[model samples]
Target: MDHKAKHILIVGGGYVGLYTGLRLQRALRRELKSGSVRITVIDPQSYMTYQPFLPEAAAGNLSPRHVVTPLRRVLSKVRIRNGKVTKVHHANRSVTFEPNAGPSEEIEYDVIVMAAGSISRTLPIPGLADAAIGFKSVGEAIALRNRVLALLDRADSTDDEEVRRRALTFVVVGAGFAGVEALAELEDMARDAVKYYDRLSEKDLRWVLVEASDRILPEVGPEMGRWTLEELRERGIEVKMKTLLKSCEGGHVVLSDGDAFESATIVWTAGVKPSPVVNAGDLPLDERGRIMTTTKLTVSGTNGAFAAGDVAGVPDVTNPGQYCAPNAQHAVRQAKVLADNIVRHLQDRPLREYRHKYAGSVAGLGLHKGVANVYGVKLHGLPAWFMHRTYHLSRVPTVNRKVRVVADWTLALFFKRETVSLGEIESPRDDFRAAAATG
Candidate 1:
């Protein structure tokens, strides 16, 4: 093989991008050091969020800072570009890169990996874009925590019945794992927080969950899903099945089932679609807008190009006629195979096919409450909750982050969860601007 220098560009710094870059830097250390190979990772943010911990971060079970791993620190050997890939001209072996500031430029690469993950899937429900918040990133999680606590404060300070009722009512849309865990965790936090307020109690708060489908947590199978539904209902949470949010204009929520109410807090965790960046390239894509890839993790019909994780429709060889589910389990495992295949391709060696059997799912409902179906064994309540924490803790990226998360969890055991609102952080210049106007 020629010893000419080669540049490998990885788009998006999420699970696949980070892990693949980390592995490539390690696997090709000599080549990298000798200037024979180079790797660059680009994303809007400089860190990779450990998404499974987002709910816990919102609930104060984990620190927000610990929920993300800095890409630069993790991929030290690779170049990190904190920006966006506006367009990919694969036919010309280059992409249009837009940095956080300044003009956009085109970057040429010998090989490209499309790991730009998915975004929150939303609908055209009335007032959704303005009134509802998503539960995807760390910023959203922190903002949600602050919003809930702020609303609680408002409810306690006011004597108006209608205002208090609106402030205390919380509505969460969708019933998937993200929705269930978020609702459960936030409810637990709010219930504990009410103890500190003289005029507020658990009874004053109303938590409602709406699902267009008949069941929630469908990933855990029907039996476990039923158990979760009953558990939420027993806790005084209104679980509306086969119902849709027809409108939520200006905090007034209307349902498809003809129910209407006023709520100050509305959370949307319905679903996710492939990142729009996938559409900016001439790559072969499936009907669902995901980049198409073979079992070996290489982009279909494209040389020196690859894709994995939520953005790629990787065929599941273990299950005939099915593509791998877009989840952390598949994404993490696929990263390993993707990195190896890239190296194998470089060395002119036969690439290994990516295949992994489906493992069961685990989700934390709240503190000491969860459900799990690993392999064929099923668990519920406390045992499953322990498994949920244990499994995710083991998967968190770095030793530094893992230790910090464990420390946060350890402190929570002996102390009460913090319930303070820092909503002002979202708009830090507001107070300064007000002072300037007064002067």
Candidate 2:
């Protein structure tokens, strides 16, 4: 690390932190003098995942690598550390990091930006934390893809009808964008994969979407949500609205509404809560557990301490009734302001508040179909779907990732999306062991 320069330590290399550091590098370079600054970004993963493309990655429409922006590559001027941040010392302006191998380290900073983002919000449902998978990062997306394809292989190879049926039955526990699109994309992929399996047919598989709400995609209004329900059901996906998964025991799911089913895939995208880091040191947080912040984006009761993204409950100015919902668009913009504020603070300048309106929600519903609500216009089916992909591909972090993503889509236009499940990627040596043992 460059000890001679002033350091701006940023926590969480997710949407906000990554983008904040990216802007800080450029802003600080133009905004600061030589030996004036060094921005250090610390997070467990070294890449920022473009979450919107995860459904496509799960469906094999975009290559997994194309959706991720490597922090080191993108933020060359910033020091990148791959580790978990344990504590923030506001008084001393230092942060404690627990590296994978080295003794716990502490780095003093002139300013700190809290952009740790959020984690998968899980309920206390039995067997969920252990058995259910999360839909937050690249690993889970890749894992879900692998599992979907593996289910087909397992169905094809198995002689037991019960086992095959269970293998083909997929349960996604949230009807939000992540849950809906993941289930939709994978279901489309799995259904196509049936052609390669002798025993497996589209009829043999089941995709169940369980939501506790009265309707799905609240951002898109009830009508569109109902239309989505019809569209999914028409495609053979069981949209179980007004219900939820009560438990997951021995790969069997118990729904809250007195129903049960056996399935190999259980994905939890119910929503997200603030990272415990926001309140880990007993920081001031709103009742909902998010760090309280002003529209200008500073922690409500603290000076020199800033929080944004999934953690900061910045009041939504446009909608008087609520706080800004934690989404990628807000996170990306807030990071820019947060970085600017930090730069101004360093120069003893005035800080600016954050303000933005909801641009509405966009969702990919597998293949050429999608759903979106921008400004008051609600859309469903193919047109919405095209807009969904177009919008996300445009904002996916970097030109490198953007080009690769566009190429992936362009190539996919000519080729049918790869429905072939590489589930064996989860356990690569399974095939070799069976043949060698039998031989």
Candidate 3:
């Protein structure tokens, strides 16, 4: 057996990348220690965010720091590079890496794992890039939390009715898990926060959810989706289904239904497409720009190349003629198979195919409110909400993060939700710059 050293390069540090690296480091511990196997993970961010908790973090139900795990700490045995893969030249077994600073360089590898995940799929709507925010990253979540609270403060301090009204209206686009949960959780937080304000009440706040599709939470089936819609509407949230956001020019929302309103906050969570980095490679891609992979998680017609998670179109053998849904459930499970296969490939052993049954879906609407359909059993309201938190808590990666998140929730039971906005953190240098100028 040739024990020559081999370098494996993972393209993204998201769910798939982090988990695969973790598994490989542990499984190939001897090889890694002996310098026979080298693994390098390249990502723009140093931490992998538990995206399921982004809504809770934004709602002040959980701390933003607790929702992310540092890649260095978790993948201690693997080399971590804080950079983005600008291009993947799989034909040459190298990729172009662009660091946070300086020039781009090419990184060669023996095995390349295209775990680069998806990004928010947005339209070219007018003023969208400037007026709207995405709910993808931890930074975006924290910024949004501050933005919502700061808007509340602005509305309270303003004398003009128009300004107050605009500041009070919040619009969330999309009705999927991200959009719905963010809207519900933030609305709950704002409703609770209004009690502390002298002039503001829950009645003054307008929460609108715009969905181009007729149904929301379609993953949970139509019955549960309809139930969620009713529950949100019962809470005074206007659910505009089958309606499109025509434009949000200058914070003024123009809907396809001919309704117009002013909202200071517009959240976009409609959909996500494969990362553009995939296209820069010579690998074969599907029509949707996702890397085409077999049931075994290996890149189609390519050796020493694998892909999983949102970036890969992995065939679901369990559900014939369909690809696995790009979700955390599939990503986490696929990582285990991918890591094992990499080891198997290295050892000249047969690789195992990746297959898993769909475990339904659970979504938290707000505190004590949720909907779930697990293995044909349906649950709603408090039970579903509890399941939502419990499931995500169990899946949040490290024990440290799980413990911290639990502590936050435990404290929330005794204390009121934090409503203070730390918008200044976004630009910490602003105050110092002003003071220096005066001096």
Candidate 4:
């Protein structure tokens, strides 16, 4: 609060923003408590979600609440603001935030960290926006979880094959880490859900994976992609590659590969683009609309301004051919350097640069099935799946959340996944109407 205190304002509460804020608090514990420095984190969401666990959350393997780390409770030293930044006048060293339930408020800062992160990168496919749902965000994940369970319920009560097929047919477009893992996990669960319904059978349901490229899971290389295709095909899951979504109006998936399927569930996880917030203020953006930053994590042409993670187009000094891809792998590594350079700026020390090798990618395909490549070491089957859980559990923020997550896994070892779909929570209106009518 003091005039001389260096105020560090972080513009997001995601992988980079949350980690950086917490790191700063730990590193400057004495300074922050003494009011020598003030840290502020501005984000619309009150929590930072562990995105790698999203598939499990959607598949009922993990609770949504458990995966998200509350910003205030964890980063107790930082002042948390719940609002969207409508305008960022970085030139004036101030930003305007539009509260969720109130008018906009402005705050000034000595240093700003642009970590607004990426949004669901959508395409212009016809009727896709209305017909297809994205697989990001806690809301979207919970909604998809409900939709999946509800589809099973609808199928159980109906005798019509037409309706049954539509309800059971789940189409996932895009075979990236998100799309592939989602389809694999959800299908595994749906197949399990049908066991409780006498009317529904595993064979009756159809799962389709439509990818724009010839290979799925492009991050693990073509051979691994081919291996995944074979695995999917063996599971009786339709794997259509090099196909484009021509139209998906009314849940009818029309593809370029001469296939048209009727489905009630359509998930779009094709790609992601930087959020519009990158261009919201006066921040410099690259062609992809990502905030452009130097190797030292400093925003180009700005002294106290820096950025990293998905929203930042941080130069990939390790790879000359491209910038760092938008993934947690790069984001976490970037946060370490970003935090160091920020301290460097404070003490007039030379700023350290961010240079990380893409340590390969990992994907979980439900239980006992996964694909991973680390430092050119390829792993699959149960080993990859176990490694996947171990890696993420270790990376998930905070000791409290880590213990709970590990307990969730330990219990999973003794019992099957929870089938109870808290689907009603997705739409409280149903219960509200029931209560009103009963009253």
Predictions in order: lDDT: 0.93, 0.84, 0.94, 0.87
Residue-wise C-alpha lDDT for candidate 4, range 231-345, written one tens digit per residue: 8888899998889999999888899978987999899999988877887789888887888789999999887899999889888888885898889988888888898888889
Candidate 4: lDDT of 377? 84
- Native-vs-model 1 lDDT? 0.93
Every model's Cα RMSD, please? Answer: 1.4, 2.3, 1.5, 1.4
Strongest candidate by lDDT:
3
Model 4 quality (TM-score)? 0.97
- lDDT of candidate 1 over 304-403, digit per residue (tens): 9999999999999999999999999999899999999999898899999999998989999989999998998899999999999999998899899989
Any runs in candidate 3 off by more than 4 Å, and if so which? 1-4
**Model 2 TM-score, all chains together:** 0.95
Total clashing residue pairs per candidate?
A: 0, 3, 0, 0
Which ranges of candidate 2 are over 4 A from the true structure?
Answer: 1-4, 30-33, 427-439
Error of 1 at 92 (Å): 0.8
Q: How well does candidate 2 score on lDDT at residue 285?
A: 77
The parts of candidate 4 lying over 4 Å away from their true place are 434-439
Which order, best to worst by lDDT?
3, 1, 4, 2
Worst 10 residues of 1 by lDDT: 1-10
- lDDT per residue as tens, model 2, 1-439: 3466677788889888888888888887853447668778888888889888888888898999998899999998888888877887777777788876689988887767788889989989999977799988888999999888877887889899899889988999888878888989988888777887777689998889999988887767777878888899999998888897889977889998898978888999999988878766645778998887888788777667788899888988888869888888899889888888888887889998787888888888888888888888988889999889888877888888888988998998898777666666778899999999999
Work out how many backbone clashes candidate 3 has.
Answer: 0
